[model samples]
Target: MLTINKDKSRREQIESVSIEQLVPHDHLVRKIESAINFDFIYDLVKDKYCLNNGRPSIDPVVLIKITIIQYMFGIKSMRQTIKEIQTNVAYRWFLGFGFSDTIPHFSTFSKNYERRFKGTDLFEQIFNKILQQAIEHGLVNMDAVFMDSTHIKASANKKKYEKVFVEEQTKTYKQALEEEINKDRQKHGLKPLDFTHEKVKLKEIKISTTDPDSGMINKNEKEHQFGYSAHIACDKNGIILSCITTPANVHDSMVFENLFNKTKKNAGKSKRAALDAGYKTPPICKLLMDEGIVPCMPYTRAQHKEGYFKKRQFVYDEYYDCYICPQGQILEYSTTNRKGYKEYKSDPKVCEKCEDLGRCTSSKNHTKIITRHVWEEYMEEVEYLRHTKECKELYKERSKTIERVFADLKEKHGMRVTMLRGIEKVHMQVLLTCTCFNMKKLANWIWKKGKGGPGKGKNLEVLLEFFSKVVLAIIKPHLSFIEKWGFVNNLKRAFARFSIFGVLLTFH
Candidate 1:
C-alpha cells in the first residue's frame, strides 16, 4: 500500500495538448485580450518605424502590451516582467506569442522607449483611446470633477542638494489675474489699483544635483526630500481625465491653470469642479466662475494667531467703506498697498482706553488692522457654495475619486518611488500607470456589464441599426451644404450627429 510508482520518463506520442487549452477561459489575461484593441499601437508608432530601411523591428504593439502587463500585475522591473512573460502561459497567450518564442531582452523596452517613444504623444494617445472607450460605455460622469496632487519620492537623496540663489519665475497668469482683480474692485465701487509697476523678488533655493529636475520639498514636520508632484483630475466616476507632473516645490496654486485647461479639454463640458483648500485662492475661484463651473471649495483655515480677535468679528460696512469693530469703532481703509491688499486700521486714540485692549491689539498704537485681497469677494462666493447641499455632496466624492486614485497609484501601481530620473521619464511612468489603470477598469466594466441580460442583446441590434442610420444621415446631406459651411459649422454638425448617436445607444 505504501509502494510508490517509479517509472522512467517516456516520450508520449501525439498528445492532444494546446497552449490555448492550458489557459483558463476566465483568466484576466483572456478578458484583457478580448476587451482591449491593440491595433491602435501600430498607427501610433508607425512614424517611428522605418519604411524600407534596416531590419524588421519587433512589434511595438507587443512591446506596449508587455509594459501594460508589467503595470497590471504590479511587476517591479522590466527584467522580472520579461522573465514572467516567458514562463507564464496566459501571458504568452495574451501577447500572441508561442511558448518557444524568444522574449525580447529587458534592455529592449528602455532602448525603444528612449529612441522611438520618448517626448512623443503616443502614450497620451493610447490613454485617451482607452478613456474614450469608457466614455462610450457610459462609465464616466463629467458633470463634476475632483482635483488633487500627491508627492512621489524622486530617485535622489535629500543630502545631495546644493544651495543656490534662484530668480523667481514670473507668474503666467499675472496679466489675467490683475485684470480680474481690477474688475472685482470696480464691481465693489473701488478704484483700480496700479499693477504696471509690480516687481518680482528672487529667493534662494536648494537644488538636487542627482535628479536636477526633482525639487526639494518638505511636508508636515518631516525632513526635506527630493520629489515630484502629480496633479490629477478625475470625473465623478473616478475616471482620470488628465495628469500633470511638476517639481514637488511647485505649489498647487501655481500649476492650476495648466492642469485645469488639460482637464477641461478631456472632461467634456463639466459643470462644476471640486478642489481642496490649497486651491481656494481668489484667482482659482474666478477662473472656475469664468469657465461656468461652480467652485466647490471648503472653508479656508483662519489665519489669525492665538489671543487675537478673529477678523470676522470686525464686520465691513459697505455704506462707510470701513470695518465695524466689536467695540463699535470704525476701522477705516488706510491704504491699498502694492501687493493688492486693502489694509484697514483702527483709531489708536480710541483704542488706548478700550476695556478689551488686551484681546484687541498689543501694538504700541493700541489698534488692529485687517487686510483683504482685492478678489476676496470671489473667494467668499466659493466659500458660500461650499455650504450648499449640492456642493457638500460633491465634496464627499473627492475621497472616493481622486484620493483613491492616488492611493492605488502609490500603494498598488509602484508609483510611490520613481524608477527613472528626470521629469520626462517620470511623466512617461505616470502615463503608463494611468493607461494600465484605465485598461483594468475597462476590462472589468466590459466583462461585467458589456453583455446585457436575457433578450437585451436585441438592444445591441437596435443600437447598431441606429449608428447605420446616423452614417446615412451624414452622407445624405448635400455636397453643396458641406461646401457652403465653414470649419465651425462642420464641427457643430459632427457634434449634433454624435449626440443623436448617443441618444439611440443609451435608449435601453
Candidate 2:
C-alpha cells in the first residue's frame, strides 16, 4: 500500500538554542577544548600587545587556537579553516563565538603570524607546556629516548638552484675533540697525530634561489629538489620531546649534539638512547658515552663485506697492545694517522707462508692493514649494548616510537611537503604541528582514562593523585614555613591550575 502525507508551513518565531546544546557531549572538539589549557598563550604573547592599543587586536589566544584547529582537522589553508569555522557549530563553540559572530579574515592569520609570532619562541614554549602536561599524567618515560630525522620537500622547485662553493665553518668542538684524540693516543703508547701539515677540504653545494636556506636533495634517479631535514627526539612512549630543522645537506651526526642538548634541557635526563646506522660514527658513540648515555646502534655496512674477516675477528689484546690474527700472528701497532685511526700491520713474510693469505689480503704486498678510530672503544661499547637482551627489546620499541611518530606526522599531519618557503617558517609549522599532536594525545589519554577505556577511570584518578602528591611533596619539606604563612590550601589551589586537576574540578 502506498500512502502520501501532506505538509503544512508555519510562520517562523524567534527561538533560542545554545551552541553548546547543538554539539554532542562526546565530540572530539569538546574533548580537545576541555583537556587543553590555552590560557598560557595569553602570557606568552602579552609583550606583543600594546597596553593602550589603538584597537584591541583579535585575541591572540583565539588566533593561535584557530591555527591549531586548522592543523588538527587537516584543513588545507587558513581561508578554508576560517570558512569552515563560520558554519561549524563545534568550532564556533570551541572559539566561544555566537552563531552570528563574524569570523576573522583569513589574511589576519598570516599577518599576525608574521608580525606577532615571527622570530619568536612562543611555539616552542607551547610545545614544552603540552609536554609538561603529558609528563604530569605519566604518559612519557624519560629513561630512554629514540631519535631520527626525515626530509621534507621544500616549497622551491627542483630546477631553481644555483651552485656555489663556500668555505666550511670549523666546528666549535674541534679543539676539544683534538685534545681528546691526543690524550687517547698517549694512553695507548702511540705518538700524537700532527695537524700542522693537514690539508683543508673545500666543499661545493647547490642552494635554492627561492628558498636560499634550503638544500638540494636528490630523488630516485631524478633531478635534485630543495628540501630540509627535521630531526626529532622522542621518549620511549613515542612523545616528541624536542625537534630541530636543518638543511637536507646537513649530516645526521652533525646535528646530534645540538639536538641532544635541547632534549636534555626539555625532557630532563635520559640515560639511554637508540639510534639508526647513520648515527653509528665513532664521535657520536663517544659523545653519548661521555654524557653517561648507553647508545644502542647497529653495525655499519663496512662490517658485513663478503669474503673477508670482520674487524671484530681480529682480537685486540690490551696487555700486549696488539691484534692477534686468524693465523696466530700478532699485528703490531705502527702509527696513528692524521685521521685518528691506529694502524696495525701484519708481517708480510709471515703472511706469505700462510694458506689464508688469499682470503686475508687482496693487496700485491700480501700484507694486511687494519685501521681503528681513536674512539673505537666507545663504538665497541655500543656494539656490545646492541646485542644485549635489554637493548634488543629497546630496538623493537624503536620502530614503534620514533618511526611511528614520523609516519603519523607525514601521513596524517601533512608534514611530507612544506607549504612555507624559508627554514624559519618551516620550523614554525613543525612546532605548531607537534604541539597539536601532543595536545591530541593528551586529550585522548584523558578521555580514554575517564570512563570505559583501558584503565577504567582508574588512570585519571591516579593521575590526579599524582599531581596532588607532587604539589604536596614540594610543600611538605617546608611545612613549618608554609604553616607560618598560612597559605597551604592556596598553594595547592594555585598548582592545580597548571595540571589536570583544575579541569577535573570544572568538568567532573
Candidate 3:
C-alpha cells in the first residue's frame, strides 16, 4: 500500500506558431532624468584640475556619479567601488558605462580628493543645491527648526594626541606631568618635566608629529582630549543646512549662537534656534536676541550647586544700572563698559552683617560681585523657553532631525575622523565629505526617480528604444540589408561584460 514510485510528472508538449506585431513606443529619458547641475560641478572641477595640471579628470560627471553610487550603498573604499562598477551591469548602466570600458583606479580617486580640488567651494554649492531643491520640493519644514551637536570622532593619529595640561602655565597634576614627560621622551629627545615644548611654541622646534595642529587641550578641563567639534544644522527632512567645526577646546557657548546665525540663509522659514546648555553664555545670548532669533538652551546646572548663589538670584536696576541683593542690600556699580555691561560689587558693610555669609560669599574679602551682561532680555526669554513643556518636546525632536545625518556621515561614510591634520586641512576635508554626501543623496534620488531604481534594469528597455530611434533617424539606409527590430535588445547579451561573473567565480 506504500506508494514508492517517484515518477516524473511530465506534461505534454505541443508545437507552437510564431506571431509578431509592431508596437509604438518612444524614449523620453529627459523627463525621468534629474535636474542636477552635473555640468556645473564638472566645469568647476575641470577648471581646478586645469589650474593644477591634475591627472586625467575622468569626465567629472562620471567620476562624481560613480563616487555617489558608492556612497548610496555604503561602500567604504574607492577601489571596491571601482570594481563593483566595472562588474555590475546595472551599476555600469547608471554610470553610463559602455562595453569594454574600465573604472577609475583607487589611487586616482585619492589623488583627486587629496591634492586637487581640495579647498574648492564644492561642498557649499552641493549643500545649497540640496537646500534649494528641498525648498522646491516642499520637503524642508523650517518652522522652529531643532538644533543639536554631535561629536564626530576623528581618525586617531597617535603622534598628534598626547598628554596635555589644563591651563598651559604649568600648574598640572603630578601624574599628568609625568605622563607628558614620558610621551616626549619616547617620541622626541626632550627630557621629563622640562615644559620646553608644552606651551612655548619655539622657533627652534615644534611638536614633531604627523599632524601639526589637530585639536589640542582645553587646558582648563579634566578631560584632555584634543579634536574638533562639529556644529551641524538640519531641516525637518534631515537634510543638512550648515555645519561648522571648531577646536574641541572652543567653548560651546561661543560657537552656539553663531552656528544658528550661519544657517539663517538656508532656513526656509525658521524663527527659533534651540540648543543644549553647552551654548549658553551672556554674549551669545545678546547676539542671538539681537539677530531676532528666539534662542533656547537650558540653564547650566552648576548654578544650583550646594554652596553657590545662582546668578538668577541677582536682580538688576536698569535705571540705576546696579544689582540689588535679596537682603535689601544695594551693590554699588563698579564700571560702565562699552560692551553695554555694568558690574556691581556687594557692599562690604552689608556683607559684614549678612546672615548667610558662608552659603553666599566665598570671596577672599567677603565681597560678592555680579556682572550684568546687559543682554538679560534674551536670557529671560530663553529661560522661559526652558521652563515650558512645549519647548521640552521640541528639544527632543532635534536629535532625530539632525543627528541622523551625522550618524550617516560618520558610521556609514567612514568620515568620523578627518583624514588630514591642521585646522585648515581638516576644514577642507570636512567640506569635501559634505560635498560628497550631498551629491550621493542627490544621485540616489535621481536614480530612483526614473520609474524604478537604476540598479534593477529600470532603463534597459528605454535604452533600446533610444538606440532604435537613433538608428531610424540616421542609420536606416546603411542597415537596410539587415531588417531587424529591437537591435539594441539583440546586442545586450553580446556586449554585456561578465566581470561580475568572474567575481562570482572567485567566490566559487
**Top TM-score hit:** 1
Weakest 10 consecutive residues of candidate 3 by summed lDDT: 19-28
What's the lDDT for all of these models?
A: 0.82, 0.83, 0.59
**Tens-digit lDDT track of model 3 for 1-508:** 8888666553454445221111111111221234354566665565566645545557766766665665555575667878887776556655666546776776776576667656666656655765676567555667666555555444445355444433432221233434533563444343434444535432221232555454543444634444667777776667667777766545565565566666776664476766767667656666667667666676566455587677667777767766778776878766533333445788777797789777777887888877655455667677877888877777777677666778887877656655545666566545556555554555455555643444445567567656556645564464533335544434444435533322322311
Off by over 4 Å in 2: 1-15, 168-173, 187-200, 218-224, 303-306, 349-358, 364-366, 452-508
Pitting candidate 1 against candidate 2, the one with the higher TM-score is 1
User: What is the lDDT, from 0 to 100, of the residue 32 in candidate 3?
Assistant: 21
Q: Could you give me the TM-score of model 2 versus the true structure?
A: 0.81
Q: What lDDT is reached at residue 170 by model 2? A: 60
Model 3 ranges with Cα > 4 A deviation: 1-37, 49-57, 70-74, 83-90, 98-100, 113-116, 159-208, 217-226, 256-258, 267-269, 336-341, 422-425, 432-508
Clashing pairs in 3: 154-417, 155-417, 166-219, 167-219
Over 158-201, each residue of candidate 2 has an lDDT whose tens digit, in order, gives 78778898767566457666777788788778777777676776
Clash count, predicted structure 1: 0
lDDT of 1 by residue, 146-199 (tens): 999999899998898888887786676778767766775675677888877766
State which candidate has the highest lDDT. 2
